[model samples]
Target: MIELAAIATEQRNPRSRHIDQVSTEEMVRIINREDHLAASAVEAIIPDIAKAIDLISGHLHDGGRLFYVGSGTSGRLGVLDAAECPPTYSTGPDLVQGLIAGGESAMFRAREGAEDDESLGKKDLLDKGLTEKDVVVGLSASGRTPYVIGALTFARQRGAATIAIDCSPHSPVGACSDIDLCAMTGPEVITGSTRMKAGTAQKMILNMLSTGTMIRLGKVYGNLMVDVKATNHKLEERARRIVMTASGCSRDEAIRALGQSKGQAKPAIVMLLLHISYEEAQKRLQAADGFISRTLTTASTEKGIR
Candidate 1:
């Protein structure tokens, strides 16, 4: 079957004629206009996004990780989303993973003709020991990338929950996955240059997926990032500030407790809130399922607080 994305590429739009001749201001306007459509495309798919999120929340509660697979621009977007989860949610490296076609080498230099190989996708999933309990999200702008479709098919065979994110409805990728999130971003400004509009839509949707999943996993408290890891100097500083702000501790007190906890933001927050030593705070957190809010509330009541 001819893929919609490939067919789109074969299309000719008069608006695209002499695109090279457009003035700088007109080019920016046209691009911006096309970009604006991305939001509407995303908005139309919020129900699908929420469905995926609910599934992810349930999977994580049962100790499953989130998995993403893609090729080309879609692959890069998946990788980008997976990379942000750890710092954003204090999750271990295993909690969120992204696999790109052609492996890690494809991240920089495009591996010519690699995305067309379906076996490569199947092998990549098998290499990862993809299990029935995890979630698999395949990203492809055209919704029919052989690689993505193959991965989705393999995921179903393994009993994993499957999802497809693509730009076309009734796509081969959509047919294979359990959940399909099709966002129609229309023709690209540059006429079938999916790296433009479709790519942007996919990136936006993935961002929403990961962010929503993290929030459901309790990574966010109100509007604050409550589970961020203090892994670097700047992050350590931000952790101190967040702890200080959350527990209303003095700078010295927050810094001391943060040091006591070895720069672990959540434990230090508990330490300040409960006025407990770091070790006690650590034990409390472990007992409370690692939620700082719950740990602090329990400790405060145990100590006869309001």
Candidate 2:
């Protein structure tokens, strides 16, 4: 046996011991109370999470990629985060990726046995052409999934930066990572069902990792997703709104600037704020490394000099 008894996540919760017999409302209250612990657990690890953000952002800025690997719910969360980055930040698909144990099919269906095969983890990274310039984050709530352990091991061997997100302290998965993000969410209400508190903590940490990295990379401007890809009608409207908010322009002016910048909110904001053409806004953005604030600052300094 794998000795799961020692794992904190596998243990039962005292607060929900009689949940089966409790009233539905009481049961919900118990669950909600326990859910609060998840956020507290994540709060305790803010420093570690911030360190991970710095590591990931630095690597990405240097032309590297990020990969999230796991199985089951963990895998699904990774995929969800990676999928949102592109439309939110206007990044290419390959910039951030998610890999599940049984590949894409495992994402929709449970492949419990697939998580036990340690070799499959290594093989999956190999398929992705693992390189030193990449970063791999392994997610496993229990901190003992063989799939995640193998993936982290392979990532380290390949000289890629490795991060581990698990709910158990001093987990096996944590041992394999360069930066261990262990959020001790304790036991679940259902006992051994890590999908509850553990999942929430993982999701919160992931939100920090991806969003913080994007901010550091200049994908954001004044709390706005300036690089948002207006792929849908809603996003097109959002892009216009972002341009207007950043530049204090009328809706019509926002639309005109976006039209000139091909619906890119960042450059449109620059065009409107700096009173420059679309081409000039792009040049300034490139010169300032895609940071709207920096571009505006440089433009102000140059105008003062003139």
Candidate 3:
């Protein structure tokens, strides 16, 4: 059996040995000080994060999907990121998915015991009909969770691109992945409570991985969320603002273009910028594989166009 004491995450913090005796103010200060370590640890693995982003973008561009699988807090984090992709980037529901060890119900409540069953991980991926072109990311702070290990192994055997994010180096999940992202956010302020520093690092890393992938996929234009789905009044207003900012048009012009483009910010901006019909701008965007920049480049190159 693996010794828990040898694991950095499970090891006791020498400085926090007397945390129980500290005043509330001192406790909060100590916790805040330790929190910076998580971000620092994540900074060290940026190269790996960049590589994973590139890989994920390539597969997604080729009509593949991205999947996140984990258990407990890790699982919840995965689900949270996956759920945000649709509204944030205008991606389809099938584009990115999250699977937890104990299934969807696990997100609301803790299912710690479900993580021990390795076969459930494989079954979940199979249930989703995982394809060879898909990318599967396994998240496990301890790096030894059987559920995540099984998911990565199944992904590898099926020719899917596999990525492992963990807090421990040379983790079991990392060994099965095409790329390993180990943030090495050591022991928690409360000893073995990985929900602290380790979870923070994992969440930060997930933000980078998914946001970078979407940016690379052309969901962003000039740092603006051009592909944002205006599902609500707030988002619709934001979309109009994005069009105005991108096209340097008045609010009235942006509103007209958005109406013509059926609330799509990218095409609306393209229509305003190129003085073209909304339909033509949309066709160009589609032909350019949804890349507004590329479509604009082509439109500019066309002699006496529009």
Candidate 4:
């Protein structure tokens, strides 16, 4: 009973009317040109995105979690963003989570019909033990996905903060949330194939939301991922490099400091820069709420006072 024609994402694009007859190079050019509009669309909604970031960051600071719920491409993007946070920011796995309509298997194969069952979305949140302190982000390109709407509704009912990310303005998912981010990428190059421009916009927005929240949480120091988990050899090297960059120490000194700080780049930098023991660095970092810059500044001020 939904009017697909009225949906901006479902409308036929006149620009790609003859895309089938165009040259291969022309096709690429056309798609690339259309992709450019995705950034502009996201730029137009900066204020809403900022508000969502602040809301999520505040909740997280208070020991709350963030959940992303969606279906299909939107769901996959949410999962991807959530999965990357732990390695990138050294956050716990429980901090940010992603829920899809058809569950984990849907991430591989398409579960197109599962998006219609609204109850499934609510069930997924319940399984996660969602609480009032958490934040839920709903992703739906068309803005009318029952799965996302249901998730947002349940989140609000549980007294949790809710945010919506969609491509259509004044969407149903948006209406159910506290903050709405509509990028309005318009009709896709392939008419209704939202996985193209809409997906890009969603990815960009998700990147901003997660990255901005992490930065505000002090996971970043001078644009470096100070809390990076050095699980792999490459990441270990990167951690040493990050320590060297942040503390202006030599490679050997950086490695020594990282070893002293148990391979933690933030405390390693703090140890080298403040000429303090690993335990003192840890205490200072804790006192500064894990902000490396703040810890260094406080140490310097205390030294001056003494």
Runs off by more than 4 Å, candidate 4 = none
Look at candidate 1 and tell me the lDDT of residue 158: 92
Using TM-score as the measure, what is the rank order of every candidate, best first? Answer: 4, 2, 3, 1
Model 2 alpha-carbon drift over 4 Å, by segment: none
Per-residue CA lDDT of candidate 2, range 18-66, in tens? 9999999999999999999999999999999999999999999999999
For residues 150-190, what per-residue lDDT tens digits would candidate 4 score against the true structure?
A: 89999999999999999998889999999999999999999
Cα miss at 203, model 1 (Å)? 1.2
Order of the predicted models by lDDT, top scorer first: 4, 2, 3, 1
TM-score of each: 0.91, 0.99, 0.97, 0.99
lDDT of 3 by residue, 40-155 (tens): 99999899999999999999999899999999999999999999999999899989999998988999989889999889899999988998999999999989999999889999
